[model samples]
Target: MRGLGDHLTIGERIAFYRKRRGYTQEVPAGLVGRSTDWLAKAESGRRRPPRVDMLAELARVLRVPLGDLLGQSVLLEDDNQLDDVPAVVMR
Candidate 1:
């Protein structure tokens, strides 16, 4: 199956995760200590966060790995758990 990280910009990925987590723009914006305008700008691709730590906080609030927010792959499946379904997400 395709992942959320595929064929998406970083801003698109953030909006996707934010919506999936049932967050209003204000929710994560507040949680990450930013204004709504900041998040809106980010989601709209009008701005990019200047710090990796800021990105990490957004990922935390949205319950996704930072790599996912960055539109990069995150492999969560364990090799020993071959019987379980894989939930790998990729850039």
Candidate 2:
């Protein structure tokens, strides 16, 4: 079976937020006092979820609500089934 890692691609979502906020990995890394390579890993999902502090800093630097970064909207209302899941989404 595929590992849990294969099923979760928060990196893509993180990349989306990063681009929407007009930041490259380097810029946000500078703001959050982490190395650019570290940021790259996080964006690529090679690293697990960043610390809450880092997430907050990234959200502020990107000019998006923290909830957006955290995906709060989907957390409560949906199963968040992976795209590969056979189930369908319902309203």
Candidate 3:
């Protein structure tokens, strides 16, 4: 099966994870100290990806590891699973 990280834009990836984690735009935006409109613009590709510093906070709010949020290879300690997920490079 194809992973969520495949061939998706940064905005799309963010939206995907956000939805997978069961968070509305308002919930994560508040947790990450961003406005709902900012998250909407980001998810819609109207704005750039969040800053690097904010990525960690976003991951935290979304209940995923930083690597997962960044779409990088993440090592799962419990099962020793390694996922080679492609990252969406923000311009």
Candidate 4:
């Protein structure tokens, strides 16, 4: 069956998550300090994808993992593995 994740490009993925999170196009653009026109072009694939740093910011504004925007999400099949995750101290 066709699904939300099916046949999605990077741009479409951004749009999908933005909508799922109840954000208007302008909302994420504004939060990322970019113009709606720029965000529109990104969502429509009229321009090259944003640079990695900018994409990271966009992911942050959209409240999604950077990997999701970059299409690198990995699934942990075992929930118990969460206990194995180590906490990190950021300097």
Number of residue pairs clashing in candidate 3, backbone atoms closer than 3 angstroms, sequence gap of 3 or more or interchain: 0
Instruction: Please tell me which predicted candidate would have the highest lDDT against the true structure.
Output: 3
Clashes by residue pair, model 1: none
**Per-residue C-alpha lDDT of model 4 across residues 1-91, encoded as one tens digit per residue:** 1245547666787888889899899999998888999988988989777776777788778877666776655344466221222222222
Instruction: Report lDDT (Cα) of residue 65, candidate 1.
Output: 75
Residue pairs whose backbone atoms clash in candidate 3: none
When 1 and 4 are scored with TM-score, the better candidate is 1
lDDT of 1 by residue, 1-91 (tens): 1353267766788888899888899999999899999999988878764256687788889977766776554555566322322233332
After aligning candidate 2 to the native by TM-score, how far in Å is the CA of 55 from where it should be? 0.6
Worst 10 residues of 4 by lDDT: 82-91
Please give, for residues 3-82, the per-residue lDDT of candidate 3 as tens digits: 65356655676788898878889999998888999989988889888775687688778776666656565556677553
How do the residues 1-91 of candidate 2 rate in per-residue lDDT, one tens digit apiece?
1122324344555677777677777887888788988888887867776766667687678766555555543223366432221221222
Q: Which stretches of candidate 1 lie over 4 Å from their true place?
A: 74-91
Which of 3 and 4 is the better model by lDDT? Answer: 3
TM-score per candidate, chains pooled: 0.73, 0.63, 0.73, 0.71
lDDT of prediction 4: 0.72
Error of 2 at 1 (Å): 31
Local accuracy by lDDT, each model = 0.72, 0.61, 0.73, 0.72
